[model samples]
Target: MNSDFLKYQAQTTPHPLAMEISYANGSYIYDSNNKAYLDFVAGISATPLGHNHPKVISAIKKQLDKYMHVMVYGEYIQKPAVELTKLLAKNLPSSLEKTYLVNSGTEAIEGALKLAKRATGRSEVISANKAYHGNTMGSMSIMGFEERKQAFRPLLPNVKFISFNNESDLKHITKKTACVILETIQGGAGFIVPSNNYLQKVQKRCNEVGALFILDEIQPGIGRTGKLFGFENYNCIPDILVTGKGLGGGMPIGAFTASSKLMDLLQDNPKLGHITTFGGHPVIAASALATLKEVTESNLMQEALEKEQLFRKLLVHPLITEIRGKGLMLAIITPSSDTANSLILKCQEAGLILFWLLFEPKAVRITPPLTISNDEIIKGCEIIIDLLDEIQQQ
Candidate 1:
């Protein structure tokens, strides 16, 4: 199977953590050898309720029995899609009432960019440095890191970048700007959290310049940040809210929400401005709806904060420099990039799953499932600390 995977399948990276999985449940995944590996990455924050969650699976099964994709999004009134959007609106701020569902977070970013351009009649777009929005052409154009995006040049035009959390860079967002998109908490940049009301200040600047403020909550939203949306924690609301990852409960989905008046712009004038065949697929929508219900109704959001405390309290070592981020969205910053890489690989070998952030080579990702037990937290942290101790001795 490993040989076949290397030969037949295209891979994003040369060295993939090719774990032949037998099955996964709760906070643990069983490999082909029946080795129980404690899950701390949660499929890179895609499975908030954990793998094969009963409610998400039941929702998917029930929807499959009823129907799947009926028609393109917005054309058919599918119950799952409708209920999911309605519930999302109920939870979100009033300005962000209407949602346009799509496939993957990049697509949502694309749609939000289009809407901002359509509404503001501007072409300039601004993003933060060291930000990772997505891989699509438009999203990549705004990606702050030039090294990763240099290969895919000739991207969208008039896109600019500013230093994140740098108040002086707000001068770049002029009246010609269409939108300024930022992650509620910069994920790939070592789980960096906004400080000194930076997000609120950005919102104020965008408002003053008539450019839309867009927040990409793909990694930090969906009850992972002790709030339904990370923006809630910062005391600022964006004109456009983009979410994915955990929102689908391990299923593939993405959504962009804005005011009804703003989203309505995609309806007429141009007519069918943005269309997707499987954006609101019934089966996926059912899973997302169930996930939303569980996250909102259950005490998982509050537990995320408590779990974060547990992780911080337990994961104490000399090699560990600091832990960045809040709630379940966290990154353990080691002294060096080599140390971070060693820690992740060693912990995985020791029956614990740990991963790395994209741009921040010195930061080890620890985004576990929200449903992880305290015992699981202690066990995982022990493995990490033990591995760190071993590395320190070397």
Candidate 2:
């Protein structure tokens, strides 16, 4: 099976953590060998309620029995999509009321960028350095890191980058700018959190210049950061809000929200401006709606903060330099890239699942499922600490 996987599956990386999965439940995944590996990465923060969650699975099953994709998005009055969007609007600020559902985060980013350009009649877009929006042409164009994007050059033009959290760089966002997109908490950049009201200041500058303020909450939103949206924690609201990952529970989905007046622009200027066939597929939307309901109705959001404290309190070691981020969205910064690699690999071998952040070589990702228990938290942290101690001794 391993050989077949390597030969048949096109991989993103040369070496993949090829775990042959038998099944997963709650906070643990069972490999084909029946080895129970404690899940700490949560499929890179996609499975907030954990794998095969009852509610999400039931929603998917129920929707499958009823219907799937009836028609392209916006043409059909699908219940799942309608309910999901309405719930999202109910939770978000009044300005961000209407949502455009899409196939993935990158596609949502593309739509948001197009909308910004349509609304402002401007071409320039600004992003933060070390920021990662997505991998599509437009999103990649605004990706702050040049190394990953340079190969895919000749991307969208007139896109600029500014140093994140650097107040002086706000000068770059001029009246010609269409939108300034940033992650509510920069995920790939070692889970860096905005400080000193930096996001609020950015919004202020974008308002002053008439450019839309867009926040990509793909990694930090959806109850992962002790709030429905990470922007709520920072006392800032964006003109355009993008979300994915945990919003669909373990399913694949993405959405971009803005004012009805702004989103309506996609209709008139050019009829059928943006269209997607399976953007709001019924099964996926059902799963997302269930996930959102569980996250909002349950105490999961508040418990995320408590779980973060437990992780911090337990994961104390000399080799660990710092833990950056808030709530379940966290990265353990090791002293060196080699140490980070060693820690993740060793933890995997020791029946614990840990991963690494993109662009941040020295950072080990620890974004586990929000439903992970306290005992599971202690157990995972012990494995991490034990591995760190072993690495330190070497």
Candidate 3:
């Protein structure tokens, strides 16, 4: 199977962590040989509820019994999609009352960009440096890291970048800007959190310039950052809020939300401005609804903060320079890129899963599931600390 996987599957990287899994439950994924590995990355922050969560699985089963993809998004009123959007609206700020569901975060990003252009009648978009929206052309075009995007040049034009958390950069946003997009908590840029009213000042500037402020909460949303959305912690409410990753609970989904007044613009002026055949498929929506319900209704959000404290308390060593980010959305910065790589690969071999940030080679991602228990947190941190200790000894 491993050989077949490599032979048939087109991979994103030359070497993949080809773990042939049998099954996963709670916080552990078992290999084909039944070797259990503690899950620390939560499927890259997409499985906030952990592996094969009962509530999410049960919701999928129930939805499967009813129906699957009956129609494309926005064409038919599907119950799962409608309920999911309504619940999201109830949890979100009043202005963000309408949602357009898509298949992935990048797709939602594309849709949001389109909405911004349509609503404002402008095409210029301002993004943050080191920002990562997605792999799609529109999302990629706004990406700040030019090295990866250089191959995909001639992307969406009129997109410019500014240094994140730099207040003076607000001058770059003017009336001609259609929208200014930013990751509420910059994910790929080493989990950098907005500092010193940076987000608020950006929003204020956008307001003054008549530009729509869009927050890409793809990695920081769905209660991963101790709030329903990361922007809630930063005191900045975006004109358009984009979310995905952990929102689907394990299924594939993405959505962008705005006020009904702003969202309704897509309906007319050209009818069907953005369309997806399976954006809000019933099964995925059911899983997402169940996940969102569990996240908000339970103590998981608060637990995320408490767990973060536990991680900080335990993960201390000479080789570990600093920990960046808030709540579960965190990155441990090592003294060197080699140390970071050694810790990740070594930990995986020791039955602990770890990952790296997209652009920060010296940073190790620690975005575990919100449902991960105290025991799990302590165990994972201990492993990380032990590895760092070993690295220090060497």
Candidate 4:
């Protein structure tokens, strides 16, 4: 099966983890050999309630019995899509009343960028130095990192990069800028939080310059950070709120939301700014609705803090320099990238699943499911610490 996967499937990496998954439940995944691995990454923080959650599975089953993909996006009055959008509006700030559902985070980013340009009638876009919106052209254009993107040159034009959490760079967001986009928590960049009222200062600058503020909450959305969205923690609201990754539970979904007046721009000007075939698939919407219900209704979000403390207490080691992040989205910083990789490999061998950060090589990502048990947290962290200790002796 491993050989077949390597031969058949298109891989992003040459050496992929070829564990043949048989089944998954809660915070654990079982391989074909019935080996249970405690998951800490949660499919890159997409599974809000963990794998094959009862609510999510049940919602999917119920939706399967009903209709699926009956109409194109925004063309039909799909009940699940409409209801989900309405529910999101009810929870979000009143200005973010309109929602444009898309296939993935990158698509929503493209839509939002186009909408920003159309609404403000400007072309220049600004994003953070380590931002990871998505892999698409527009998102890649605003990504700030040139090493990975230099090969895919000539992306979108008039895009500039500014240092993340640096208030001094707020001046770059000027009247000529169409929009300023940023990850509320800077996911790929070590989950770095804004410091010293950085986001507030950026928001003020954008307002003064008439540039729209787009907060990409793809990784931190869906109550991963003890809030519905990471931007809420900072007190400033974004003109455009982009979400994906965790929004669909285990399914694929993305959306960019804004005021009705701002969102209406996508309808005119070019007469259909952005369009996608499977943006609002009914089954995905059903799963997302179920996930949102669980995250918002239950005490799962608040319990995240307790779970985080448990992880911190157990993940102690001289190799672990610091634990950077809030709620379940944490990164354990090791002495070096080699040490981080060794610890992850050793931990996986010890029946614990761990993963890496995209840019922060020395930081191992530890964003588990928000519904992970205290026992599970302790179990995973113990494995990590034990492995760190073993590797330190080497």
Candidate 5:
């Protein structure tokens, strides 16, 4: 099976972990050998409520009994899709009353980019340095890292990048810019949290130039940040809001939301300007609705902050430089890439699941599930600290 996977499966990386999974529950994943590994990575922060969450599974089951993928998006008014959109509208800021759901985060980004250009009647898109939106062409086009995107030349033109927290760089968002896109918390760029006054200044600059501000809350949305969205902490609202990652619990989904007046632009310019076949999938929508309800109504959202405090308190060592990010979206920065890599591999080998950020090799990701218990948090942090100590001794 491993050989078949290696031979047949398209290789994204030269080497893969090749860990065979049996199943997962809560914060743990069982391997084919029945070894339980503490999953701190949480499927790259996709599984918000954790593996096989009861609420999510029950929702999927209930939806399956009723129906699944009944029709293409925007054609038939599926109850789950309608209810999910309505729920989003009720929770979102009044301006962001409409949503365009999609199959994944990248698709939502593509849709949002199109909507931004069409809504503002501009072509130029600006992103931050070291930012990562997704892998699709439109999202990849706005990616600020050149090394990763060097091969895919001649991408969408007029996409520029500015220093994320540098106030002076705000000037680049001039009149011709269609939208200024930013991750509310820069995920792949070492999970760097935006400094105070940075987002506000950017928003103000966008207002000055009539450019739309699109916040990518893909990684930090759905109560991961102790807020419904990361922007809530920054004291500002974006013209466009993109969400995915944790929204579906363990299901796949993404969406971009905006004001009804603004979102309506996508309808007229091309009639069916941006459309999808499975964007508003019923089963996925049901799962997302259930996930959102749990995050909002239950104690999970408030516990994120408390769990974050626990993680920070326990992860300390001489090899550690600093910890970046808010709530559970943490990145433990080491002194060098070697130490970080060694610590991560050792942690994994010792029955823990840790991961690396895409560009920042010196930081280890610790984004566990929002449902992880206090004891689980302590256990994971202790494992990290233990690995750090062993690495230092070497």
Candidate 6:
């Protein structure tokens, strides 16, 4: 299987963690060899309820029995999609009452960017430095990191960048700018959280310039950051809120929400501005709706904070310089990139899953499932700490 994967599959990174999985249950992922690997990263923060969650699976199964893909998104009034969007609207602010569902986070971002341009009638888009929105062309254009995006040059035009958490950079957003897109808590950049009311200040600047403020909550939203959305924690309500990871209960889904007035713009002037055939597939919507319900209604959101505290308490070590970000969205910063790489690979062999951020080579990602137990948290942290000790002794 590994050989076939290497031969047939198009490679993204040269070195892939080729752990052939048999199945997963809760916070445990079983390899083809039947070895249980503790899930510490939760499929890169995509599986909020962990693997094979009963409610999510049941919802998917139920939806499958009823129906699957009916028609393109926004054409058919699918119950699952309607209910999911309604629930989202009820939870979000009154201004954000409409949602455009899509296949992945990148697609959601693309749609948001288009909507922003259409609504504001401007072309300039500003993104934060070291931000990772998605991999699509428009998303790639706004990506602050140049090294990875250099090869895919000639992306969208008139896109600019600002230093995240730096209030002084807010001045760059002018009336000519369509939108300022930022992650509520910047992911892939060492899980950098917004500080000193940075998000609020950005929104203020966007408002002053009549530019839309779009918040990419793909990594930090969906109850991962204590609040249902990370922007809520910072008191920054964006014009467009994009979400994806963990919203689908292990399925693929993404959505961008905006006010009815702004979202309506996508429909007119170009009858079908943005269309997706499988955006709101019934099975996916059912799974996502169930995930959202569980995250909001159950104690999982609150438990995330408790588990975060446990992680911080147990991850104490000389090698671990600092734990960045909040709630389940966290990054353990090591003293060196080599130390971070060694810990991630060694922890995998030690039966604990760990990952790295995109640009921050010295930061180890620790965004486990929100449903991960305290015992699981302690065990994973112990493995990490023991490995650090071994590395230090060497």
**Residue ranges of candidate 5 with Cα displaced over 4 Å:** none
Backbone N/Cα/C clashes per model: 0, 0, 0, 0, 0, 0
Candidate 5 similarity to native, TM-score:
0.99
The C-alpha stretches of model 6 lying farther than 4 A from their native spots are: none
lDDT of each: 0.94, 0.93, 0.94, 0.89, 0.91, 0.93
User: Each model's TM-score, in the order given?
Assistant: 0.99, 0.99, 0.99, 0.98, 0.99, 0.99
Ranking by lDDT: 1, 3, 2, 6, 5, 4
Model 2 Cα lDDT, one tens digit per residue, 1-394: 9999999989999999999999999999999999999999998889999998998999999999998877888987999999999999999889999999998898999999999999999999999899899998889998989999888889998989898899999999999999999999999999989999999999999999999999999999899999999999997899999998888898888999999999999998698888899998899999999999999999999999999999999988999899999999999999999999999999999999999899999999999999999999999899999889899989
lDDT of 1 by residue, 124-172 (tens): 9999999999999999998999999999898999989998899999999
Q: List the residue pairs that clash in candidate 5.
A: none
Q: Each candidate: RMSD to true structure?
A: 0.7, 0.7, 0.7, 0.9, 0.9, 0.7
Model 6, range 89-147, lDDT digits (tens) per residue?
Answer: 99999999999999999999999999999998899999989999999998999899999
Q: What value of lDDT does candidate 4 attain over all alpha carbons?
A: 0.89
RMSD over all Cα atoms, model 3 = 0.7
When summed lDDT is taken over every stretch of 10 residues in candidate 6, the lowest stretch is: 68-77
Superposition error at 256 for model 2 (Å): 0.1
lDDT of 5 by residue, 1-394 (tens): 8999899999889888888999999999999999999999899888989999898899899999998876778889888888888988888789989998899999999999999999888999999999999998889999989998989887999999998999989989999999999999999899999997789889999999999999999999999989889899997899999999888788889999999898888878589989898898999999999999888888887899998888888887899899999998999999999998898889889999999999899999988999998888888888888888888889
lDDT tens string, model 4, 27-139?
A: 99999999999999999999989999998999999999998887778898888888889889989999999998888888999988988989888999999897888999888
Clash-forming residue pairs, model 1: none
Instruction: Kindly state the number of residue pairs that clash in model 6.
Output: 0
